[model samples]
Target: MDPHGYEHLTPAEAIAYQNQLRQKINICELTTPIKTIAGADISFDKNSDILYAGIVVFRYPDMQVITTATAISHTSFPYISGLLAFREVPALFNAWNNLYSKPDILVLDGQGIAHERRMGIATHFGLLTGVPTIGSAKSRLYGKYIEPADKLFAESPMYDNNELVGIALRSKPRCKPIYISPGHNINMQQSVDVIKNCIRGYRIPEPTRQAHLLVNKIRIENGDNRTKQMGLFD
Candidate 1:
């Protein structure tokens, strides 16, 4: 599906689009070995129309940063709780186009199937790009579960009604848990396993953590100036 034109969609239209997109989400085991993985994030100032998107690719297992891409774009979509993909993915798609080294897996700092419509930013991007993606959200948007043990890698199942949606993972001791869910072209178990492997003494996984840092750094470097631009760095 094309990843454009969403900025002009009304809330109702966006929700309907999400429902349509959710039908195409394919959650299954990854068929390819992961040699490279990426983390995606977006940053913007409060009440600002400008969005700074970042995608960081890393060498898998070793988790060394390899490629970084960034994009700046103005969004017209209002900040709706469940419709964030419409507001954010256009700029992220611009950044994705700037990426020189596409990874085997893409981890996003948002919901996946763990959403009200099961169409979070990660899943939306995955369907748009046809890439294996996972959502590693810092908080839960849907579902219920008992908190996991306060230890590294402790995880508990999260369910919506009777259906399994995601996992609540304690990635670090003392830190609040993060939510893990398959975005597209991947399954729940594989999502948790990939996130576990990406953790490196941090509350957030390496790929997404690095991506968060990168986007924030770019936003700071650019200061309050906002413009439409796309940049790639090795």
Candidate 2:
């Protein structure tokens, strides 16, 4: 099944496709003032083909949740190491189409430009929607870095093949740092700063933390008995 013509491709073809899209990534300073930001995440229904995609939009500095969106779909793509965007992003696009208002930037619970392929879920989603996006993951997908200081707002540059690609951000003191990278139309430093402002005494930031809760809420309401995973990036 072709869910936008690329999902059905063979593994080799998918890698090539990722390499092609990688060229389209634009890493530059954000010119637009960020008033609203949306945190995007996806979860799978236990032992089933159903997947849920969620988006939570909130005021930037105020951090007030304004609206939320969710989409359910049967994903035809399988989970792979480098081709994660293909498995997850179609459902996200379904949710994106239902959003009340487009966010100025999207903070996603997955890799951005910092993937082995350089085209992770965050970057793919940003290109598809033409919005600035950032990827904040609980784990590192690629890039090398030393651990940042165990304090709030500490970060270290993450490099892949000797090229700086992202940041390892310590959002809260004594907590494991979250990996952050630019998805589209934003620089690495800007991505780190945006996530830092969204933290609210948790390892995960508010936008994504709220989004994680909302998606789990939707999954639980749908009769899934799985326990909620506790991480901002999950």
Candidate 3:
């Protein structure tokens, strides 16, 4: 299957494809020591079809910036809530290809198994690239959960029926909780632990928050005049 061939897919076709790939998802604990971690995000203006995808790698445990990659591409897929991977992953794949230093794990700014079909952008990307990924979404895409406590690191289990899907975590005091789920090559508990390590006085974890800022910065700097790709390293 051509991983980038999602552009021409109908909504039904996309759903079918997601169903097909989801069976391959492996949920387990990460066995390797995590020396590096990365975050991925997408940004676009509502009035434009251009998408800015950014990936920021950081030295894990310490959270120092390592390298960043950004890609600008045009997506033809319409905004479908459950099928967002079809619209976003192509550009993110381009950015991933240009990354010089791939991290040990990735924190995607979207859902993982916490989706209706259990095939969110993070899971899709992990299936495509065979990387360990976790979704740290700002909003709950799927699952039912009680509100977490107001203190930092407080969490509540999120469930779809009787199945555990994700967690609603309070990363900062008085802020809304962030949703976390394992994408691939990781488990729910490990996902929460990794996200906890990434938070630093912010509602969103540092990995994904930094990636969001990077993509939006690129979008604002480039404007809507042209589509291009760029990368930065530190």
TM-score of every model versus the real structure: 0.94, 0.92, 0.94
Q: Which candidate is the best by lDDT?
A: 3
Model 1 residue pairs with clashes: none
Indicate whether candidate 1 or candidate 2 has the larger TM-score. Answer: 1
Clashing pairs in 3: none
Give, for candidate 2, the lowest lDDT window spanning 10 residues: 224-233
User: TM-score of the candidate numbered 1?
Assistant: 0.94
**Model 2 C-alpha lDDT per residue in residues 4-123, reported as the tens digit of each score:** 665677889888877877888999999999999999888877666788889999988889988999998887778888788888888888888899899999998888988887887899
Evaluated at residue 93, the lDDT of candidate 1 is 95
Q: Which ten residues in a row are the worst by lDDT in model 1? A: 225-234
TM-score, cand. 2 vs. native: 0.92
In Å, residue 15's CA in model 1 sits off its true spot by 0.5
What is the lDDT of every predicted structure here? Answer: 0.91, 0.86, 0.92
Task: Give the TM-score ranking, best first.
Answer: 3, 1, 2
